[model samples]
Target: MTVALSLGATANLGHAQNTLNVATWGGAYGQSQEAAIFEPFAKETGVSIDTVTYDGRLAKLKTMLNDDGTVVDVIDVSADALNTLCKQGLLETIDASALGAGPDGSAAKEDFLPGALSPCGVASVAWSTAIAFDRKAFPKGAPTAISALLDTAGFPGIRALPNNARYSLELALLADGVPPENVYRELATPEGADRAFAALDKITGAVRLWNKAQQAITWLVEDDVVMAASYSGRLFRAAAGDRNIDILWDGQIYDFDAWAIPKSSDNKKDALRFIRFATVPARLADQAELTAYGPMRKSAFPLVGKHPVINVEMLEFLSTAPQNFQKALKFDAAWWRGNGAALQKRFAAWRARVNAARTDREAARKAKEAAEKEADKAAP
Candidate 1:
């Protein structure tokens, strides 16, 4: 089932003999990988890592892996994508023994968080999608919970939500008073999907939908929105430069990203070596220092300290920090893996209805204005 890579494609022309091709989502995340993972791994093992950027498209990964000559050795994938790929037999099942030991000589399974060690991948970092608000817009009282994000009367202003249904439905259910623990359980049923969409219906007109993580941050920065559902890391970076932007950790949806190798990759050995080297507690902590994401390994928390460049402490901004972690909702990737398609279809239908309603409203307003102008001309 393995696809062979052409030697020319993988051979480091002017670099080290061994090369590992890694795929990641670009931007700050990519920079962090270069500084915290790739460079250090190359220095240690002489494996020159070639980084590529993608939009986390599973189809692209599948196509590359299924082709006769594939170049992607390792990829950074979201938990749900990892689950889907693993189910489809697209990714390699990593050996826990191949993963290096923790500082105290604990096994990889024992070292990583409860759900971190999957058959296809190991969790890299813990991140969250939380509510971020502009301080100047909400000078006195800001949103304190997920409920407030949906409550137009309580917190009146334009709100931004991700165009996708992933976190959107979960946040709606939470706002409707579904307990964090029961969110995924309830979402499994038809009634639960109805309730989530019903909650979303209330704020459809007031919400500005954003497709990109940076777009959400931009809306908050330009005052295009009073508040937005944002990736915690994006908001942290924005807040670092602009104090006016702040994140509300309450009801944040916490999830992890993992490093997975394509089943057909030719450089599985080098990829495994890099994964083992990069995921060790100290290296994981290094990643956290470079970005706002929390380290995946429990042991890494003890090692995480101040930001490497910024003078601020990293713990307070991390999703796994005690105060922030307490009220957060740990995303259920299993539920998404099982019910995602059906729910996505329902969400699409609901969105179409909302768009139609908006169009109707605009049409009515325009017709009324036209009639008013015509009547005034006749009177004159």
Candidate 2:
């Protein structure tokens, strides 16, 4: 019996005869998918999700591809990586029409966030990096504006930031008083670069850089720093564990992460079925209930529920929420794609210099202490 699926009908996949492997970021985001999609889908369709985790590194996927294709069936990738992979023919072309319709009978193509449904991939979440702080650190008051990141005197403390120059430069410019709309324009020039570097220099000595989102969260948990620029997903996860981390959505840099099928996927049938099952409107909404990442489907927005453990409404924490999202700056991946190499080299040099200066300062302080102790002994 060939069941017909129309534009209005939702897809309900049958039991999977074989296992389907999924690749995703294994953190709060992965746990959300586990609760919302993978576990439920496995029970419903009998397709156990053999999930693997990876940081968003494009080269890893390329290197993993073999004669038959990639070892994984479906992948969760960033929008930027999706574009790069699709252009390189590293991914399989998915029929966008195969996606399930929304609960309100809206077409799959229409229910999804604009530009989210693509020929090669489908967007899962829209996440962002926001200025996060420990509420306990600010005994006087919490910062409500983006400029608080640069005001060392008003909120005196060390800050943690991601090692990426792209976000650092953007936030530096934002804190330096460049208006949101004009940020990219200003950052495109030499003086703007100097201004941004100077803005960062205001707290360069006080900044503790982190390589992972979790590292920044750890610092906050330990009270090693007052604030950090961190991912919404990591913050939400930390908050769920009873950490007092709070985020100011002001000046957040947001972007999308999509799911793509590698060209080498041997189990394309089960993979396609899994994709459809995972992206159903209810599943998308369910995932959002568990994490701070915004579902890429507009239909999922109204269906978003409260956190199962924390019991707070999820919408308020989302990057796409009306109040929080209004002040956000959409991360310009295309712009970065064009200018990243040069800017990255420049940032590397600056970091090298900063590290060297810190080393020299530490050495000088130790030498001064030893000299003072020797002088005290002679006087005695």
Candidate 3:
């Protein structure tokens, strides 16, 4: 059961209101949060919590921060966004002293993963963009490496890739034989950008772009595409029900999702309370059991044992698992913050050209078939 709060009641309400409004990426992720974090905090403190979804757009967040009567109290954002927002002074700097210690009484700062805690944000989960493919689609052989995704001749079928340049560029560079450690360095240069785009050109004919994470898994299950780049957690949930779907941990791009509060939020006290309660080692472990995302707290690992619903061990499926994590790349938040806009413009232009070419080809194919039918009629 998903915990869904009515947006109508939360909107147009000022900080003077009693409820705490949280922005999250809704769907299974939101559901896990509702079960493991929000619901428990609300029950314990009697604080009314309202949840809303966003596309992780910075403009929407900036608008909310600029408004004195904004309803948003806390938001879940990416590390790159958190860094950028913190630097811009749009987010409230969290008081480390107020966060307290972990369940084991260890220092909070020491318990979290390295670089997990920022001036204005704290990480909730470590997630990744991984390759997921349908087992049945590749009967003779399956794609086991990142390069297979770009090798259309070897594995022919529709490929679903994210519309964004962040992960797409990294994967393209990696497929083009760029070393994991050097990916961001290469992406930072004009020549590297050209190389990444050139690599993408090879598979443009077979690629289908998806704007949302869930759509990647849906496209695979529906057979709309044979292979898809998806969030590891989303693919895990879908794979739990459909045995044929499996994730390739190789070359996965790992990153964290952080919780941040707008500087102008009226409910900072309650928001802090919720964040503290939710980040407790036990609570973080509970969330991991509900979803495949790895907890940011190192103490949460020992507590994360099994899937709350499926009874399967959750560690093996996590992106941070020892065996699975070996071949993955850490997403460079600073690099993206510096180069995102320029690369995004390039990516948009390339996608538009590819889409237009595909449209022309489809139109020409239809026109030729019609002309052939008319010729057949005349011959008869």
Candidate 4:
């Protein structure tokens, strides 16, 4: 039921608006980007930057392109989404040679990290999905390892997990003792996936599902859930503020977020100019000053200093930092994109089965209690 998109096709950018509509993430991430990238680009270029918030859903982008083809001028898409969009020809090609040179006068290509450059877009930042747990939940001890995620007895508490299978399956495998680097390779096989599901089965009744990134952190703070899988930046924001939570970087899944021009943009020229300006070493490092995401440019690494508000070192929290990258898993977007449809069907069926079983158990328990009550009445 999956179709491959035509890679070489192009879309038209309709009539121009006075301002460029740039679609991006919201929350602390958005605020950081506004300070580091958007505001600066707008101030210097004299072109108004009109922001549009989105959940990074491709279907929505597809619909916008199909409807008018000029609603959103630019976008901030993840590596996986960018790959699909590039194939669909929904994005304008970015000329790497035209990008601004690094502060050291190095060419953009040489300065960017490996896999950071693509025809789809220029990667802006590297972020991670790390486990953030409530500090007070574990009275016995803290869970410093990935294996503790599924060890319900060792770390007994309700959990919050994303409803999607991508991270869930991978984390389950890691908890089941799969070697860090071999996780994707192992997941590529039938037995590996089965092992992952079996691992998930061990903690069935204790999980609360979340559909959005915000839901994970919200549940951790407001609900009875003890721990959650969430974006590291969100966790950092929560921890930096009032949330009694700390990050567990073990088994972190790392990936990139990129700046891309939607082919439907009426202002491709302006979007490109903004992209070039925003990706400069100084601008990228400025983002790191505010959030936990690591700038995509290698030169930006050293320029990252302390968080201006908190006055703490920012490098340690970055997904690229040596200490954090040791056991980190690079998210295999290609694998997920390829197998997504089939696995989504399988995941839906599995969820149905799990729910049905839980419902049946509840019914049986209630029936047994009713019979015991009648027996006590008859005996009296």
Error of 3 at 362 (Å): 7.3
Question: What CA RMSD would you report for each candidate?
Answer: 6.2, 5.9, 6.2, 8.3
lDDT of 3 by residue, 97-148 (tens): 6675976788989988777788899998889988989889888898888898
Off by over 4 Å in 4: 1-21, 26-28, 52-55, 63-73, 104-106, 136-141, 152-156, 179-181, 211-219, 222-225, 242-244, 263-270, 306-313, 332-334, 341-380
Off by over 4 Å in 2: 1-19, 25-31, 46-48, 52-56, 68-72, 95-97, 137-140, 179-182, 241-244, 266-270, 310-312, 332-338, 348-380
Tens-digit per-residue lDDT, 310-371, candidate 4: 98778877876666767878798788877767666766766666566667767998999999
My TM-score estimates for the predictions, one after another, are 0.78, 0.76, 0.75, 0.74
Residue pairs with colliding backbones in model 2 are 69-264
Query: Over all chains combined, what TM-score does candidate 2 have?
Result: 0.76
Write down the lDDT of every candidate, Cα atoms only.
0.82, 0.81, 0.84, 0.80
Model 1 lDDT tens row, 1-380:
11122343435643225777788888888888888888787666656778778887878767767874658889999988898899999899998888888889888788787678899999989899998888787766877777888898888877888887899999888888898899988888989988999999988777777889899889888888888898888888888878888788888899989999987777787888889988998888888988989877878888888887887778767887666776778888677777899988888887777677668767998999999999999994
- Our tally of clashes for model 3 stands at 0
Screening candidate 1 with a backbone cut-off below 3 angstroms (N, C-alpha, C), the clashing residue pairs are: none
User: What would the per-residue lDDT of candidate 2 be over residues 266-374, giving only the tens digit for each residue?
Assistant: 6788788888888887898898898778888877888888888878888878887667877777788889887778778888877876677668767998999999999
* Number of backbone-clashing residue pairs for each candidate, in the order shown: 0, 1, 0, 0
Q: Deviation in angstroms for 323 in model 4?
A: 2.8
What are the clashing pairs of model 3?
none
Residue 259 lDDT, candidate 1, scale 0-100: 93
